[model samples]
Target chain A: MTKISAEGICKSFAGPRQRVEAVRSFSLDVREGEFVCLVGPSGCGKSTFLRIVAGLMEATSGRLEIHRDAEDGRPLNSMVFQEYAVFPWKTVSENVAFGLAMRNVPRKERDARTAEWIDRVGLRRFAHHYPHQLSGGMRQRVGIARALANDPEILLMDEPLGALDAQTRTVLQEELLRIWQSRRKTVMYVTHSIEEAVLLGDRVVLMTAHPGTNKAEFTVPLERPRTLQTTTDPQFSRLSYQIWEELRDEVQRSMEENA
Target chain B: MSSGGQRNRTREEDGKAHTGAGLMSPAAGTVLLRWVALFVLFNGAMTVLRLWEPLWWAAALVNFVLLVRIAEQGALLVPARFARTYERSLAVAFPLVLLAGWQLVVGAEILSPTWFPPPTRIVRALWELATGFDEFTGTSLFGRPWEIPARLAEDGLKDGAAAFTAESHLFATLMRVFAGFAIGAVPGVLLGMVMGVSRTVRAMVDATLSAFYVLPKIAIFPIMMLVFPNPFGEGPKIAVVAISAFFLVAINTMVGVRDIEPVYLEAGRNYGATGRRMFRHVIIPAALPVIFGGLRIALGTALIVIIAIEFVRSRTGVGYLTFYYWEILSPDKMYAGLVVVMILGVGLTTGLKALERVVMPWRRDPGRSDPGG
Candidate 1:
């Protein structure tokens, strides 16, 4: 089934002296249980595209739909925002249970689900701690737990591991794949890292910067449980190198558009 | 503390050839030089006091030498083997300096004891006033207590509560201050929160309050008395105290709201938190420390207004007693009543500080209080 479909989505940011077209006539579709990552240079509007899918922002002229079971359940889409977006005032457990509470989940059920996810993320020891008390890596764990506790059909992630240390990022990347394998949820991940895209995604969607439109889409032959060993493999480098060639010419266009 | 200390250490390390553990150390000479200078200043003041013996000089020298020993270890002011902070050094040094300066003025006899009321004299007066329970009781400093239809000592006062009792007077004054403070503070806090949050309310309300706050509450008291019912029956002078506290709280609440950080609000936005949740969880906690600060200022202002109002016309409390003493021109009694007022100020300030510690335990800049603030 098509978990989510985006049809010719167009978006622009209106400035005082000019209208800056960010994404123009962009379109894509993600099948249920598929992992997709969008990658580009700095100004690619990759985050904007993910935000549109999350229903955080509206497209100027396009149709985006989430196909879910309409009779008995409503589809939920949760976003893991870039950096430390976890609520500072809430404990790890409380932050993870935020969506559940919003849906008026019973106190007992919320705690039970939050505890299960906290243990899943290896943050059982830090469950009572506030977000400010945790490091960047721990906070991201809380964010993941918060999103998964809602049991959403679609997870929209905007550079979730971007602020973490090198080691923490590597660890979280594997953890994310492990999470996806167990849950089999459709995810639209945005990032600037090419290796991350090749390793985690089933399909990599590359976006051009100026009036950001689809540049090219590549399917990674690399399979599940992909790790650093995959990066050393010849196929991984060939796919990553091919993506870089298209990205380098488009990066220049992005800079000119920004100027 | 970690970030702030790390920042300082970075600057220090950049300046020196040292790195890491060595960078935590200060220059021995710098610490020694400060220690010697402080000891000299303390001794210099003691010389004027004419109370320093050879023993004090010896102790001062020993203190200087011990300070130099620690300074040499590159651990100056890190609190000796006892794990003490440099705060002690500052605390001891400041009071000693003030006393030294005070002793010089008093020793020179530049002013008469009567007019000057030196620290020694105030201490003596306080002691004598405390001991003379009978002579000090049952009368105003001027000569008599309040005119009471029945003895107030018999009614509600516990044993040893007061030197003398006037039924109508003391209750009237206590009730007035309490009632006025409550009447003003409640609305003041509510209005303050509203105005603090809303641009519309703030624009409309701020002008009127700023104008009211600027006016000396005492100056407006006469006009207010003319407009309202004085009644003169005397349960409490509630009007006088209310006007004082209301304006003070309102002014503070406005300032406290403005002091909150914008980043906190941005953090709340992603959670889809708005309206009441935003206020309950974010804005109020952020403004709490500052609002408590305003309450401290208001408490003092409330007392001042009470005194000024009671002095104009009222039957009870220390303010009326002060007026009665001044009318007779008994300087000693006037001084005694004035002493009571000073004690009240000190008590209020101390109480507020203690209250802040209790109510805002989260606010104690953890870096400062946790072993190394």
Candidate 2:
């Protein structure tokens, strides 16, 4: 079953003098419960594409469709932004319950769901604390819980762990895997990290630099419930290295062109 | 505190080492000799001015400032044994020293006591103003809060007689400030929120608001008087204050709204927040920190405008009392009225700060530990 499909999608940004094409001729089909990671260099429009899918932005020229079986009293998609975009003014529990509260969920049910998500994210102790009081990784956990508590049909994550330290990133990667293993919702994850793509995604979709379009796609033949230790596995290293080899040229070329 | 003392001791030791070396550092030696020369010059000038008599007070004031500067330098040159205690006491001691100097100079009869009354005279006038009612001026400080119970007992809280118990200049000024602040600030915040959220409204009003914002609110007093039927009544006074507060709060609110991070707004939209819900939950909370900043500024502006207006027109406010004392040639009572104004300013600001804490529970002052649940 196709959860999301984009055909000949294009996005262009108009500046003062020139209209720069951000993404051109982009097309992809995402399966119902598959986790697809879009791996690309900076300025490849991976985040632009995700925003278009999440309806935060409109595609300049394309037919993007999200097919749903029936209304499940949940939104079509919820986004986990790169910057941990959680409200600093709200407490951890309030941030997690934001979506439910916006949907006008009953107070008792919202509190229960908020508590459940906070507990799942291992932030029970800090539930009443503000985002400024928490670490960067803890703040991102609030962002994740905020999205998950919405019970959306699909989750759109754009470099959600990019801002965290390496140690915190590894910890969150394992937590994300364990959570996804239990839930298995369709996720479109965008990242610059080849290892993160390989470690998290069931299918990795590669994109080109400048006027970004689909370059290559690979399927991960890994076991379920992958842990942080999975990154040290022979196959995981080979797959990550292979993807990096494909990406290294584009990354250098993009950097040179940008400079 | 100990660390500060240790640092000062090291500095003094360094200074001593430089002096101990027969070749004293030219700069340090010059500074020490200069202060010593200033100390001698100040005393010599004070003695010479005392002999001269009439113009001696002016010379004494100059010498006193020089003495204070020399003392400050001397204090800094030495290592502090208890730096924190010394620093705390300096605040109280410095003012007391100034007061004593003032009393000594006035007692010497160098200047007329009429124009320059001593601290003792000011204290006596302040005490009288606080406790007694003036039959001639028909005004009092605090409406004599001490007499409120007595008045209540006599009048039995009937026929508005109890109101007379607390009808002082301080109360009058406080009432105008609060009434005007409330009248102007509420709608100012609402308009500001509207202007903040809507580009069209902001564009329409931005120029007009900015133009009026820079204009001195007191400049429009005559217009305010014309707007009200009773020109001599409270309407015009409060109107000026309200106008000032309105502009400050509205401008601040607009800026606060405009300054909200786009990411927060996007998150709110993505989470399905729309219209009133978005405003209440996301927009309000996001802009609250800045809005509070604006409110504090608006409050200060309110006090300034009210005092200025009272000085110009009113007969009942603290500002009027200060002017009234000046007209009657009572400098001591004038200073006493100024003290009341200072007290009012501090009290009102403290009240607003308390309100800010209640309204914004999420905000934490740096270095203050959170009393966590």
Residue B220 displacement in candidate 2 (angstroms): 0.2
**Prediction 1 TM-score vs. true:** 0.70
Q: For residues A1-259, what per-residue lDDT tens digits would candidate 2 score against the true structure?
A: 9999999999999988999999999999999999999999999999999999999899999999999875757889999999769998888999999999998889999999999999999889888888888788888999999999998999999999999889889888988999999999999999999999999999999999877998889999888778888888999999988888888888888999899
> How large an RMSD does model 2 have?
5.9
- Candidate 1, clashing residue pairs? B140-B144, B367-B373, B368-B373
The stretch of ten residues in a row with the least summed lDDT in candidate 2 chain B is B364-373
Q: Write the per-residue lDDT of candidate 2 for residues B252-342, one digit (tens) a residue.
A: 9999999899889989999999999889888998999888888888888888889889889987888888888999888999988888888
The DockQ of each candidate is 0.16, 0.36
lDDT of 1 at A224: 69
DockQ of model 2 vs. true complex? 0.36
Tens-digit lDDT track of model 1 for B1-373: 5895596476555535653446434654465566567667666676787644434545445555545444433344254564444555655765665555455455556444454545555556545444443234343322223322233445445422342434323344555666777787877777788888888999998899889888887776666666666545342356656776777787778777776665455444434456877777677766777677777777788788887777887666668766775787644445666677777777878988998877655444334211100
**CA RMSD, predictions in order:** 7.9, 5.9
